[model samples]
Target: MALNPPSPTPSMFRKKKSSSSLGPMSTAASYLSAVRAADARARARGDTPLTTPALSLSSSVTTSSEDTILDEGEESYSDILTYPSIPPTSEQVYTTVHSEFGHCSNEEYRAVSQHPAGKPVAPHVEQDPPYYVLFTTYISYIILILFGHLRDFSRKYFNPGEFKHLVPHDGYAPITSDFDSFYTRRLKGRMDDCFSYPVTGVAGRTIVLLERESKDSNRTFAPTGRKVRTLNISSYNYLGFAQARGGCADAVEECIKRYGVSACGTRVEGGSLDLHSQAEGLVANFVGQEDALLCSMGFATNSTIIPALVGKGCLVISDELNHASIRFGVRVSGANVRMFKHNDMKDLEDLLKEVISQGQPKTHRPWKKILLIVEGLFSMEGTMTNLPSILELKKKYKFYLFVDEAHSIGALGPHGRGVSDYFGVNPRSIDILMGTFTKSFGAAGGYISGSRVIVDRLRVRSHSHTYAEAMTPPVLTQVIASMASIMGVTPALPTSTSTGTITKSRMPEPEVPEAYPGRALSSSLPTWMDLPPAMREGTEGRDRLRRLVFNSRYLFRGLKKLGFIVYGHDDSPIIPLLIFNPGKMSMFHRLMRQYSTPIVVVVVAYPATPLVTSRVRFCVSASHTKEDIDTVLRASDYVGDVLDLKHSDGERWPLERIMNSAVELVQMEQPSHD
Candidate 1:
């Protein structure tokens, strides 16, 4: 039901009007007389005046001083009542009337101000006015009061119960559970404590950093602003190119000098410069694509381009574990979407066969198009997609494929050409090739590399290309320089295939040791010396890739031996330490910080991963040394034991058993060529 204004009481009309008042006047004059009468009545009741001198309407009213003078020689109507020669504009009249009278008590105004001018007005009148103007004003004030009450009711009663848990009792609080509440209340005190550890210098062999704890008194371990030299493992500086002194940095400096900072607008507008074109060309050449289009942000490239390619009437078959950006894009596209289990070819095939047989939902007609989307590497799980299997399914289903290689671009494959190269699949088999320059490239944008037709279409139709600001000149040049380094064309760097061979002394230990009490404490020798010669021998880029693999394997093996359940493949740089219990997860993170050799790792919890499987994700970078890996392993071993996280038979799982299991996994993942 619609709320109404309260009816006025009879006592409100009992007040009398003043003597020497002017008779009924024009609308503007009536308003002014009402305000003056209300002000006088308020003073009689010992209440504060409605309008102070600070809010005087005299500046806008333009009343002459002579209008107030009483003539002693002749008492005439002309001398008593004075009106302006020119009527004030409606805006001016409203402003002056409201400024002087808006704050007056409505009840008091109804008693005295509503009385007829020039008459000795009383609070109680036998007859009422005939005009509807005053009645409409009362209704508006009533509506405003009702709106205020409704707003308070919604805040107090309509908001979700979860939101109240995070907010204070009285002051303004969030009425909904959103990103802020999720971070501040649910994950901030625990997960944020581990991520974004403040570092004083470059993420090198040994990083000078600060660690945070999840305590009230000392939430951060390094509260004194002191930095500790600890093993660096949290970054994605793959290929060891992020900290290059003279290569990419020099090119970026030169580019900045040639073209100031930013492109200033969208590519089609004034923002497109020669450097942008050069970078695009270099990226296309590096990735073996006919053309490439750059966007200001890597996340935006996928989110914007996917919608442009397909929309309603289209079907998007996606991996269950695809990045959030891809999910956002598919949602924006308004496409009918179906997700298959992560890396499960059999499940994907079954779903595809069912969809093909049934046709589009609700309509027994063929879909306009079908798009298959998957990531080159699942960042959270550190598992590579079975591209060969997916390609075979794509061939059978006749669907276009989109691969987001944000993590695999410069870190995967023998020559670092991404997943297609790593798996020996032809790049042309995939319909869309998307990657970001932020990770291995150490730049600030992303690119979409595909056929000439696709590139041309995106240039004109993609919302990001049409509306967003172009990539800045410095970031473009940085990407170009990194691509050159990876391609072995930079004079300052060694060629890709021209590095020294691995020495026999650097070979890894062939046998896994038995469980011992002092295994972690006994490791004084550097662990890099024990890496396989195959890992140590290669060109600079290949060597870094091998080191990344070696470190990942070493860390995974050590964690398994320590009895902590880990996730992902051994070859993948991403290793997730699974801590299923939320309270245990928080405790594990806190203990990791307090370890003698403190290390920073990314913690993924609810909304990112399932609530039941919260984990600490470690990204093994090539820049990490063998000693650095061992330090973190020792710390994990000690903490895992303290928290009773180790399995009873963890140490009994020997190297041979681990290798056999990996072989079985590979055989299961491989597609039959027959």
Candidate 2:
């Protein structure tokens, strides 16, 4: 009987090509028909493949065409594509055991090794068993260690979930080691309270666009589906200088040409350029001082200038409501510091008396100096300094006066010459005049304009001034240009005062004609009094200060006549129709969205302002015309009626109630040093 062959079993791996064959011409025809049919169906369905099923058997193959795949060894083209298949498993080699004579034995081999039926045999090794086992274990252990390290690295560097667990959330302190647990805990609490209040979720009413087809053009936010840009405020471009006379563009161009890009190093190093000197010169001339020293920043101007001017033997008497920058600078100076009550002349006199009393003792330094520090204007409450009173006390105490004219420099005094001019105090009387270029000049940097001796002393002695990066060439250049443009054209103060001191006799009656021309008596005097008291307080005060206040009055009357309970003041441009609760800010913001004109709010919160003071600050700009202001007032009135601020006391806070509440709120916001 003939030996039978074993049947083939299916293998795990599948081959891409089949080994079966067909009659030559018939196979080619059948493949062509199949591919053509496929192409027709794909075309009908709008499907396209990268490579066509057509095969080129021509010797001169065109490999450039993507739709054709060329095959080797054929003389003509064919529709079918072919690939060779693997041989059967039976054809592969298998290890087998045989007799020493190299022949299979009929009887089962029983000598040294046994060959089992239907199985392959391995070749025997001559090496020692222990050596082989040791090598195998070494290789396997190394592979496992490598795999473990790879898993650890991936978890540390690339796993998003693992990284998220490592970071701290907004309210919490990051997991850093700390030396002071109490301090860290307190800081974390403050941060949490500040962030917890929600400002974004307030409902905003859609502003009706005056454009005829605006309804279809309105866009909704993607995530929350809310409309943004309903009302906007909180911008620092005071005096609208950014848009003044191509000022912004000129600044940018100058900055680019001189500095190229960055100040490369600190002021003492590569940063100081010739433009810086030009700016310093201009500032000194404008302030009517002999010389000036420039610094990289305004904060540094205060922090560095104060500490340098007052040290071990000096005393600094500060106004209690002074700007935070001034307070911090005083603290850092390590001087014997005392604070007087806000704008209280009596309190200031008492403090000076105590300083003078102590200074008279023989044990103390004989040449001691007391520096009185105060701001020209209080930023938050819009209050101003009693310069006449302070100057009177200064004459008695012989203390040096250092006033921060930060807010007042750009907005107060005749031609904005600042507080010295406003109160008719000579720049020489102040001893040292420090101002920043960032504000009215529309640039950055600061300078101390004063007697040459004081400025020269500070130039070398100030720590940050000596060590910090200097102002950029372009920024300094722009500052110089702006000073030249504004100060050069600004009319000068009448000069040659015949030596009269400030007294009660010179004080004008409150109801004197609002517009007082010839306020500056002489052309020789570089500084003259400008801002009157009424300009800083109440309804009449605001009206005297700005045109916006007038518009606000018109708006208020219109709104009142229209029967809306409008909140806040017509005297002050910052009017807010009070919404009693947190829930109402959203509704107020929403109604504001429906107006054609924008009425932005300056939002205040728990940490920034008191909860009671948590209302929008509606600011009227000088840029707004009477018509524009009227439109805004009408819209606000309409919205106020809709929100129902008229009936509730919370909605309409009286001016006195508002002022008292403001004072209390300020007290609360201040940090308790004790």
Candidate 3:
């Protein structure tokens, strides 16, 4: 009668396990009272000595091995995930597999997510690597280019057959110009192994990667028929909502049972569902917006919606490092575009002033409107946009502000409401709030939230809404459940461990009044969505937010203390450690994967980042335990020394010492030598 995972089905997803002993879903002996009876039995039987849920309940990716249940009698594996340093006592209980969700009971590990009152938000610092590392990185690319040219030279003479694609036949244009693909053939082609490795199962705390090998230098690959399980630190699974089980998953499963897989057509073409409205309403509430609309795809949410906001006569001032989708949309919109240095408020103000003073290019006529676009959290650099400063600029310049919170929503803020919540500013101050559910909600699609007028306008004008498929019922359910968990629900039910109502205000001082939107009400969720006690009370959601911040700070600061050049704000869930040398990107990845406890990492080089600043980005999740962070720190320390990547000018801490003083390190102001 418990909510354990069902046995695996031939299909990708398995249905939730139901015991034969329990009454039927449709009460055999009652009327509309069927649902009430089922729910009553569920809630009453769920009453237990444990107050808090053993597993974290945020959005997440997949279940481990078809959501495997923890067998109390089975002997634990030697793996760190299975047999953690401090195993749970026999008296304690667990509902999750250790590989999927690391067990951490130490409440002391938690930290609140909020800026100190009256103090300025900490500025993002980019620690530069050693000059020699930069030189070598350039040399590595130069050597690859030289070899590529030499290969082309030899092939043209001795192996002319392979060069036919670049030569025109019968007056038809060649397949593609050789020069057009020079970078891909010369540079990226060599290290395709480190990128896009095949993976399976839930992308939770751990991920299962399918093994493949290539003999012709990554031109093609053949599966080795082997699967490797590795510690997952590369997914956008902030808050660990990328789960295949727990409240979120259960809700999704129920949704699939009631509502089929697809929405059948585009939103405007008779494809919208009641769940669409439900999700839109919850999303609007979550981001503190008046109303919101959903796009079937995250990329389209920006690429399609931006065109509806601005056109030929308008001006778009965007962060230079803004996502490509934004640039594409701006170009398509035919808007006059201006670029500003990433997250640099001074550069932004200068650009804004120049655009205002200059007016429309050449015509010297005033622009119809000016729109400034910035990401709430930079995915690669992990820099939080200067919201407070931008709001001040918004007041002075009177430009429409559109913040893309694709990476920040449900991952930042004390309440997990996103950047506006994180920065202690009113969400409505900004003209538009755009976010995607993929990052933190562990679901697909995106949303654009703002005043009702703006949202209603986009629905009619945006290409995605008019053409693309509406979001499916399952994804919408995941969004609603995960978001509700984060916002918390009303008509609370007390738990065995409950000690009065939970306080969400984590401000250092009490008198300052709440600076962000408050919790969600019961009416915000659907009448059918029945969340467990912990999620109902917002306890699990609160725990996940605190856990994420703790891990984020620990990883960012820990790498710096290990004498590595780590980029981004310490509170950022996305932590990038500089790899510098392009060649070592593959080496670092392979070495980490080959560790005693295999760790999967994502490596980025030129194009995504500067050539000299190639880095391995580690996305922290609440699913990770404190010990898991220690494991990553230890792995990086060993790998850094081997690859000579530790080049920052800082007091380096010993690996053992770093592991021992983690809680102290997370609590301290980052970059402090102590």
Candidate 4:
């Protein structure tokens, strides 16, 4: 119009405000023409044409030369297009370009360029074109190569053939060589199988709150949202101290404040604190030993210390029913180990005599030392060791004796001094006195007490002493406080005794009162029966032990009267009820849950015991009242009858009934013969 300026370039026209007023097809045509022209210009400048595809436009949309110029009536086109619009800053341009290529941000591209593996950008090159475009393209190619290799590797190795051997094969190897295979195949669906239940609340002698197993679970037992509260008769809270709150808890809290929790390192490093030494001294004095060494765990005390004490030239004769810790310890000791029948003094003596006569293996040389290891109380069988008989054999054979008082300590004897005090055998007769604080002490860790030489040697030689972290301050303090309560006096200094032959003293049975009719009070008395009457009258350790014995007898009698076959001694707190049939065992467990008054008891079976010899075990505590014991007894009788677990009137097991009948008939015939 008024000598109009040369028409604006197509690129400028594409950005004009009038372009927004165009139809969709016209707008597409304009964009396509602008992109084509830009590519042509780039090619004319000796650069590669833009590789990005141009926008496609419909054939009906057309643009003429007249459309490129604006009319004078529309005002100056340059005035509108050349207005001072803000230009994008470097950060804004980088962000916009990065987003177009699916990159997270420009910072990410810069980070890659700085990497040692990435290509360096030349100073002459622009920042946007080189760093982001090149690095992203390089990363994508590398990822594709890696994915190709991964696919190839998966095809070659992760195939069915790789795992074919795990299935059954017609080979010489037995199908069930180990427990894992055996449990997988044979015992797969037996849901109520023993030893997997998770208990809640206090695992005390009487009451326990536990989550019930869900009936819907198939592969494994799972706890339900609902909880069952019942009388607990399965725990090993021997002296009712597992949940002690008064003194034990107080002592632990005080030490926690002072030490601030863990010892932080191994005993040989920074873990050994003043509390550890004081606790060790207390344990040694209580056990009447010259010195004692403490370890963080009860089981490791035996498992590790045994190897440190003896080697290949030595012989270790172990009790068949000794704790698993002792069995494992003997295996690790590298000594010639021999096992005698459980609690059989004659079998032990014969084995000892034979080994002594035979001497060492192969070379037939005399053994460097012979060690006898036994437990003060057998946990599984609920029986105490024949300490007097074992001591006599040790004397004649000239062997060292190791006593594990895990169950008996703080639970047996007049002063809770363990088997030596229970049987009136001198403590000096035992070479090594090993006991745990877990059971009756209501604490964690174990102590190995003996002569100064043995204790010092173990501290230096035992791997646990050098490497394992020392017992935590709180646990050590708990043990110290609980032990003080049990002893009824402060922990005194250990006194040295002559190693000369100790005179044996037999424990006399307590005189039963004639007031109670048709009952021998001595039959229900505990090992603390020999405690002084003055001490027994008080609410001391002896009274607590006596209450435990009374509860045990009550439960034992109730089970027997209900026609249930019970195991263990009358005065023993652990009571076992036989349920030989696996089906009946599972049924008994279920029925107990369903009973009006539900009761919780432990069921022991295969692996823990021999196959088909599953039994329901009950542990009576001083905490258990007569009402609690009665409730469990009544529930057991009902469940036993419902499951047909009770023995028939004339049907004793293993030919006992037939043998008795034959004896009666022979006696009648004898009268006719006379």
Candidate 5:
């Protein structure tokens, strides 16, 4: 039951413009030809790598990508990792390693990430599980609570000394009520083994996880002096830039050798490095903004900059599911905060109307400003903010918009711009564009981009800029190198735009599609930094985006076809496969890790998600191969069958069918409801 590619209609999405050769539509061959070739490959295969390889191997076995490398002496031929199921034709040459970045050369495996022309974007649909699954999930929590209270009740009477911290100890009042830490002591303590497991090495396609064991009910952990390389879908290395060996890494090393580590003082003080200005300029260009300001830490970008943007008399309308950092910033801003249901435009509009009409609470005085704050892509739920609808509302309400693209920047849209680019909205329309480097750029820090006036105001008023250390040289270099890779080197043409922030360059740029996001100008990068040819030409960046989308959609659809409840749009790299039952969440994690390939996963429960919808979030990476996705699907299928987790509404496909039909499956466009 593959979805049909919905036809284009008139609305928000504009007609397909001439595609930019920079990324999305640029393939080895024409898309029509690639599709035909892929369809033939799928149909003509007789004995070509039957289904998925064995996945439930010993935990002692190495990761999937390394299976070929480790067993080189034992077998000379390729394994599941090297070339996946289909062997590469003699003509193909792969320069990247199968482990660091999976070897995917399929021209048919890519799709334009923009919304369909003239079609309105669809909001996310939250799938429900069976009533019994809900009952068991609730029951498990109830049982755990009962046992916790009973144990606490017994401990109080028998071992009163254990309650010293809860009681008034010595002189100071009790540190905290026993009730305050009840959940931590009881629930989180039991499952503490799953959280914060230590790891070493690059968190690329495969992460080297340190083996540790805690005997005393998760009280403490001691590493077993063992490192296990597992298929990594846990880290936020969205575009697979987190490499210890790359041109970007080399640039970072060069920067460190020259500038050393620390930024020393705040940007407002003496700590300002020339790299900061360069990175800020490139970032502004990348996002199509007039100017940009950088912050040393990702969390601080919002917490510090938001306070500078709005204060006392302003109103901040936030999506209820906004990240905690945003909440922290809003509170510090001293603005009147109101929340609407997540991604519900009608709800947001209704709330806005009520607030704008009511004005300031007591005096009914006109408000200084109203800011609509939303995350470009929510991390936990994986739902994208309805940017198109919100933009339409922005025209009428006249509220300044602040989009937190922490997870979306460089991970969404065809040009890797963000949600605005994904929805075909001009980036300038949004008042402020905020994002972090930790996710996509494989660097440390965040940035806020906007008009020159606003950025200049923030440089003086923002706490992170004035108090926090300026962005370090190495991080800035990594950002520059990686971002430059995606942008390619823009050509020289003394042509300047009205913004006057444009820089002249000597290097030639690719023929960017008219609709493509603005590329980072060559002059924006430090002249000292050197990059590999693929990156300089923007081919690697394009491949990463293509692989990421393909992997994301493959995993998402594969999970759905396997009858598992999933949240988020398919194009989004963050895929949350619902596991619902509390106990099942832990079991699912352990089973996936202990499987043949040793897939390390992140299982999220309660506070992060609604209590009943506890899930395992698979952050698909450009590093993962199509075979890697199939491996995940196979593992999930096994675990789901064991735990009775496959209750999602859908047409179920056996794991083998899904594996063989990956290319056809990826090209299947989602049907439009309208």
Candidate 6:
């Protein structure tokens, strides 16, 4: 999550003084006192406020006409504040944090008025040559002083509409060479297309299949030397469904032919349709579960389900690397959350043991009601979860499990049924299974599948479906038809196995657990993750994810062959090419600006990622051909070689340099320590 907004500062206060001799100090002093008292009372009630007001003076004026006669040769208060003999000139401008709430009177206000201590001050003592000049001259000088002070005050405070006009025009100097260089590098990199590959209308090599158009939808032009177009990388479409699949198009056309585009209201109202129920059944059928409840988006599925299932007494054991959506949902659930290390079975076991030992005394249940949550596939690492091991652990410590298959459905297991199918574990074994239709199916919606009771409970209880409108009919029809085609649920039957299971004779099998409830009866496991049909002893989701890994490896290899040291997993698609010594990220961006590439660089600063890790993230996609990968690698190679950076696999070398610096500093501090 991004950092919180900064707190307001207290330097804006003005010390209040007595406006009248008979009265106490300015009203601001009383206000502060009241605020302090309120704070004291709040603290007594155990509440702490983040902001408090400071004292300020009120406005008052007292003067006498008789005081207008000034003594000759006496200096004015204005003369003390401003030297009229010297011409006014611009002072240095420095950036400063400012206050919005405080206001003070200018020198002009003080000049003709009584002091805060109530001593009378002289009024305008002008012996004017013209009657009009007498009042006009004094008024004009006072107005100028007041305006000047007001400008100063405004500059020092943060006003909502007032923002600094921070422009990097040609003649402006930069605060630091390092910062300047960073922006420069980013601009330069962007100009040269170092972040992305060549395309027709896109600068990036990979064509991001987007379901909806974004701000840059019309900017589909790339003109590198070889020519290119814009390519969007952050698209959620995975299965190429958005490109108008024959069967999917038929389904949508059929839906439109019958139901138009939408069902039009909340599902509980008039929006419920046969298509909605059909899609739910298709999802449950694909996963080989009893029932499923569908919601508007996959984000809402988990976001709604988590908070609904777990409550105050429930302890939610979540993987530390779970998605932001899951973390958010958990927060709203009001359940006690314990974070386990990412993919660490030992950590999960320890947590389970601790919960069992600690929680049993307070509740009637023996901690078996505890919920364990994990992702089927880690999005960042592109690594598959160890579900077989997790299930084994689950067996040993009997906790309810919730698996998010956002990245797994239509991408893993036998016929892409997700993690359980990939592991040959029956879908029913998982307590709650959630998935989104954004990826693979190339549509939008999410579903939670489990027992009929759970499905019914969620249908009535899940906040997302209960409150949000049902999915549009056309999108639902397309998604349902797509999943059905993939799972062979309709007329495409029996070429596939029953109960979403298939047998294989590829290898020697491990001992199956006796009557592992809901375990699929399969003679063979899928090979999409492992090597093709060779019976390799690798992993379950191994075969399915190999294409991404292979693409990443080839890109890394090709880029390295061109001499650029990149960061990130070799087996993962998102690669970060290290630009450790860029002049500035802005410069890099400028360089890549004209280049027909679209890779984005991750900016590293003192507060962001460390300077040592400054680099651009290059994401490879399955949509990228070998030629496309080669072109991107060569461009990076050109930029790196031009910049003359000595690329290492990823080591800074001279390990002793940093260590020796520490030692020398320690030696210098020895006398002081002694």
Output the number of the lDDT-best candidate. Answer: 5
TM-score of each: 0.62, 0.50, 0.83, 0.62, 0.84, 0.52
Ranking by lDDT: 5, 3, 1, 4, 6, 2
Q: All candidates' lDDT scores?
A: 0.58, 0.46, 0.76, 0.57, 0.77, 0.49
Candidate 6 C-alpha lDDT tens digits along 61-176: 11211101101122321121111233212220000000111111111111010011222212211111233433443464355446654654575385623322333346765444
lDDT of 4 by residue, 1-674 (tens): 12221221112112124322322322222332333354445556534412221111111112221121111122322222121234322212111111111111111111000011122211111012224433544564355446644654574476845334444556645444444543543343453444456654455542323454546544555655544444466777766666423334445655666666444333536546676776776677677777799988999999999999999999998988788888888889899899998777778888888998999999989999998898886776666677777777777889999999987776666566776766656687799999999877767788899999999999999977888878877777667656655554411224445567755454543433222011122222221122222222323344456556556656655565566666554445677777766556666776665555555678776667665456788887765544455456656655766665565233222222322232232122110000
Q: What is the C-alpha RMSD of each candidate to the true structure, in Å?
A: 34.1, 36.1, 10.1, 35.6, 10.4, 32.9
Ten contiguous residues with the weakest lDDT in model 6: 92-101
Q: Which digits, one per residue and each the tens of the lDDT, describe model 1 over residues 1-674?
A: 21221221111001112232233333443444444455556656654432121110011111121121112122221232343444333222322222111222212111000112233211111122223423443453355446644654576477746346546557866565444544443344444555566665455433445433445532445444444544456667665556523334445555656665544333547546776776776677667777899999988998999999999989999999899999999999999999998877888899988888888989868888888899987898777777877888888889899999999887776567787766667787888999998888777779999999999999999988888888877677667656654554311222244348733333333233212100111121111112111221223345455555555666666666556777665556778887555555666765655445445566777678864556778777765544445556656665665555554232444433443343232222211110
> Which runs of model 4 end up more than 4 angstroms from their true locations?
1-179, 192-194, 205-217, 221-223, 262-271, 490-540, 648-674
Task: Kindly report which residue stretches of model 5 are placed more than 4 angstroms away from their true locations once superposed.
Answer: 1-58, 61-96, 261-268, 491-516, 672-674
What lDDT score is found at residue 25 in candidate 1? 38
Report the number of clashing residue pairs per model: 8, 21, 9, 0, 3, 75
What is the alpha-carbon lDDT for the whole of candidate 4?
Answer: 0.57
Model 2 stretches with alpha carbons more than 4 Å out: 1-233, 244-248, 262-271, 358-367, 489-596, 606-621, 631-674
TM-score of candidate 2 against the unseen true structure: 0.50
Preferred candidate (lDDT higher): 2 or 5: 5
